[model samples]
Structure formats: structure tokens, C-alpha cells
Target: MKVGLKLNEQFTVSKHNIVQVTTFENEFHLALTNSEYLVISKDDKDNSYYYTHEFNGCLIEVPVNEYHRIQRELTEYFGVEIQDVSSDETKDQEQPEPTA
Candidate 1:
């Protein structure tokens, strides 16, 4: 299954290419079969994320905020459920409480 992912750029990745998708609270990671790691930040206000790939000793950053979208697409594409490993505490309020 070709999963359509829209990040900093458009991408069509095979379901097989992605070994698994795991999340720890806001952090999301994708383990690829090619030993490449894709990380997505929990930032939505910036509409971006910190994505890097060791491309010949160079780390290219890809700003992406479509984490949920990508997750949904991948689940739908592969017909699999996410094995959430986060606890209730980890799902706490995202915004920090302002202090005077």
C-alpha cells in the first residue's frame, strides 16, 4: 500500500517501507526498513516539526505538522491499529500554565 504523506513535501511511501509506528505522548517515531528514522514534533502552532535524515553525513530538517494526518493515513492505508504506549499522565494539558 502506497501511503500518501504530506509533510514539508509530498511523499508516497510503501506500507512495507515503514516497519512500525510508535508514539510516546506527543512524540512520534517511524522505524523504516532502511534504518532511517522519522521523528515528528508535537508542535502544532508552528505547523512544523523537527525531521532529519542522515543523508551522507548531513542532517536535513523537514518542518512538518501533519503528524495526526500522517498517522491516520498510515493506519487507513495499512489497516492497522496503533499500539499506544503512552500513559494517562502523558496526555496532560499541552499548553503551559501562565505564571504572573
Candidate 2:
């Protein structure tokens, strides 16, 4: 899939395992296995615009258009839907701490 991503951009795909955009470095440097590597994008700028996935130690960036395209392809290929968090919802859902 062709998705946009960026360098140093962070995304939380799950509890563990994150896809980072790196041009000069590999996952090995970060103590990660290459097998866990997913897909890289065509444009590095687009790679910066990701969901919750954090691209740590990324040397390259992916464009947003390309990234979205790849996301669409992956969603169809795996038949899984991807949901993004909305800032508006976050603000409205914030709760205050209880006091004694």
C-alpha cells in the first residue's frame, strides 16, 4: 500500500509494534525485527500524516495522499476498517478528577 508518512512521526497501531519512516536506518537499530515491518510509502511527506502509528527514528517522510491511498488498499486487502480519533470528541469526553 502507498501511504504518506514522515520522519520522527509517531503512531500507535496497537499496544506494541509501530511503523516508522526511515530512509538511512532500519528497524534493527531500534531493536525491532524486519519481519514486523509493514509497507513504506512513495512520498516521504505523506508518511507524516498517519493515524496513531508512530514512525520513530524515521529518516524519510511519506506524503499524506500516498499514505491514504495505501491505507485504503490495506483496509480492502485485509477487510478491516481503520478508525481515527477525533480531537472534538476527545475534548467533549474529558472528565474531571474527583476530589475528597
lDDT leader: 1
Model 1 misplaced regions, further than 4 Å: 10-12, 44-65, 83-85, 90-100
Tens digits of lDDT, candidate 2, 1-100:
3232222256423312333322221111112244355444445334344344575433323465645544454445445643233466565678666799
Q: What is candidate 1's lDDT per residue for 1-100, written digit by digit as tens?
A: 4444554454445666778776755555777788876665545434233333533221223434355666667778668864335676654654577899
Worst 10-residue lDDT window, candidate 2: 23-32
Q: After superposition, how far is residue 31 of candidate 1 from its true place, in Å?
A: 1.2
TM-score list, all predictions = 0.54, 0.32
Model 1 pairs whose backbones collide: 49-64
lDDT of 2: 0.39
Give the backbone clash total of model 1.
1
| Total clashing pairs for each candidate | 1, 35
